[model samples]
Each structure stands twice: as structure tokens, then as C-alpha cells.
Target: MARNNWIAVASAQHARRGCAIPERGYMQVCHGKRAPLQRVAPGDRVAYYAPTVTMGGKDTLQKFVSIGLVKEGSPYPFDMGGGFVPFRRDVAYVPAQETPIAPLLDMFDFVEDRSRWGYKFRLGLFKVSDADMRRIAQAMQVDLALLQFESLLF
Candidate 1:
């Protein structure tokens, strides 16, 4: 499968919880919509961005926090059994880390104005260019060799 790049924005609390769930190995987005989730595919690289300074009681400097490879499958809705069904895909995440977005603002095309970096991530789930994805992965200290290998699989 040709690898694509995706960005998922979540609050600090949600991001921490999602990353910690082994069975729920994916990031959930657009709680009330399916269009965004439908775009993600197996083998795609995913970057989880959290806007809060503190996550899971630790200081994060408000950055992109997790990087992973989306596992094979379409979006599936997990019933939390209390009318709390969340649509998600499976992701094999790497070790969690944080990279402040401030330094990387100028590198992203979506952030036309550095002073307005936060606006670009408002959509929660969106596609990112391969170049941007690589930059983010590098910033997050992910192993590029491993990331490339993961991107090659079907």
C-alpha cells in the first residue's frame, strides 16, 4: 500500500488516554463525523497533536505527542456500551514523546502565518504532506528508518 500521512488533534486528556489503550490502539477523531475517519488507511503514518501543556499529569510543552503507523483496517466504531460509540482505526505507535510546535511552525504549509499556528489544527483530523510528515517525525525523534519500513507494508 502506498503510505499516506495524517494528523490527528486531540485534547491532552483524550490523547493520553487513547495512547495508553492497547486494544484501542488508534486515535479517534471527529466524534460526530465519519468523513475524516474514512480518509485514513492502513500503512499511513499518523501524528497525534495535543494542544495542552500538560498531559497525563506531565508537562509536554504543548506539542505533537505521538507517532504511529495505522494498522490494516477501515474505520470501526467501538461501542463503549453507554451510547458512547467512537470510530477508530488500529495504530501501532512508537514510544511516546513530545516536540513543541513552535519551532516547526515555519516548516508547515498549513501554518501560513507563524503567529496563527493553532488554526491549522482545528479540524481534528486531516491529511498532511509526506514532507511535513517526515519533518514532524524527525522533530518527534522517531526513527526514520523504522518509519519508512512501516510505510512500505500492505
Candidate 2:
């Protein structure tokens, strides 16, 4: 389907903010580092996994909060005032529910240790296999056909 499938870690508050942008959604990983985003090409599928409701907070919210396809553009810098310029890529977000990761951990090919599922997410953003992406889509209740409509193969 997508050129690549990726999992991005962010707080639910921050993830929701990116998906809430008018017209098109956006994604910023590793605190706006452009280098990581550079590896993600247009048409790739990305899902945001939120471990908490807010950044650096203990309120656990282990859910895949956003799912989308990367738009046709390179990472661009955006100013958030106070000289905070974060590089982000445009994403076309689909309608999906925030899904918990507990049920899908066993199906993850990336996670070798079931007891350390959260360890993989520490990378902030990382590429995943197609199987992993499909599993995530199913968990999120997002239609693969809907994603395929955007030129992604199954």
C-alpha cells in the first residue's frame, strides 16, 4: 500500500493537535526534528501512538490516536512563536477511533519482548512492516479500502 508504514509516538494532546489542523493534518516527531521526517516519503502511512494524555505526564493513554497518509511534500518548518520552529509534514488524516495498544502487542513484529512493548516506541518514529500497519488499521477500525483509495496498494 504505502511506500512505508510508520509508528510515531506523541502525547494524545499533541497528537490530537496535529490531526486537528484545518484542511490537512500534520505530524512532527522527535520534538520537530527534520532528520527523522526526511526518511518518510509522500504516500507513506503513519499512526500516532500516545502513551499519555499530556506530555511528560503520568496519565497513561496508550492509544493509537491518529492515522493518515503523508501528503506530497517534504518536511517544512513552522513557527509556533517564541522562536519555536518545528519541521512537519502534511498528512491526510482519516476518520478513526483512538485505539489502545494492549490488544495488538502480541501481533507486533517489531516488538520482540512482550514485557517491553513500550521500548520500541522510545524511538519516537520508526518504520513498520505492512503486516504491522494492517494490524494497526484493524485495531483503529480504519478501513484499508479507504486507505487504498488514496493510491495505496493492499
Candidate 3:
């Protein structure tokens, strides 16, 4: 299959585990031709994490997944919403390294806290690939899009 790009959106925070747990937040990626998906309610139990890309922007992708959206023991092969679908193991993730997405990362107002990393502003939009999409979906459960945001975080 042709390589695909991925993007993810978050609406909540999960820093309970401290630095060891690099934040596992729900996120989605572009699945065909759709818009970014976001959580509906505030108390929604979704996932959160520090996502990363493979190489660079050879391809593009957009994802929508936030904290308090999905549950812990949820099943796989389940639809995350939008056109994106995730496998069973695609539940949560803890980014290993700080992704070299300088273009996008530079735009954010990040605050260096005691933990890993924190962004003062939203991450906005990003790009990824299908292989990366599959990998991200497997790591962080959420939907993706190539169009626009279906909703906003705040």
C-alpha cells in the first residue's frame, strides 16, 4: 500500500503517572478523506500521549484523539471515529523521543516543566504517513483526517 501521513488532536491532559509515563493521550490520523475528530464532552475518558513521526513530510496525515475518550479495556478492530479505524492494541502511547517536527513544534508555546514536555498552545495540524498511521493507530487509538477539524478543544 502507498505510504500515508497521520495527524492527531487532543482535548485533555493525563499527567498522573509523572515523568516515567510520557503522557498517553488519544489521537487520530488521516484515514482516506475526512476531517480531524475531537472529543465531545469535558469528562470524556480518552487517551493522551506524546506522538512522533517517522522521517519527514513525504506524506501528510491528521488525527483526532483526546484524553477521557476511550476506556482502558476497550476492544480492538473497533472504530475510533471518522474514517479511521484502530486495532485492539492501538490504545495508548508514550512518545520515546521529542519528534524533530521543528516546523510545527517551533510554532507551539511550550513550557518546560518537571515532566517530559508541555505545550502552552495547541499543537495545531501535522502530517504523517499510512505506515506511520498504522503504527500510530496501533500505539494511540483515535481517528484521523485530511480535511479539517470537526470540533475544537476549547
* Pairwise lDDT winner, candidates 1 and 3: 1
The candidate maximizing lDDT is 2
* Tens-place lDDT digits, model 2, residues 74-134: 9999999999999999999988989899988988899899998898899999989888888
The TM-score-based order of candidates, best leading, equals 2, 1, 3
Tens digits of per-residue lDDT for model 1 on 12-131? 677667778655577788663567878888888888888764434455456887888888888888887889888878888877468888888887866777777778678888788878
**Could you tally the backbone clashes for each prediction?**
0, 1, 36
- 1 against 2, candidate with superior TM-score: 2
- Largest TM-score belongs to which candidate? 2
Off by over 4 Å in 3: 1-5, 9-24, 28-35, 38-91, 103-127, 131-154
In candidate 2, residue 92 scores what lDDT?
90
Q: Where in model 2 is the C-alpha error above 4 Å?
A: 149-154
Give the TM-score comparing model 2 with the true structure, all chains together. 0.93
Say which prediction, candidate 1 or candidate 3, comes out ahead on TM-score: 1
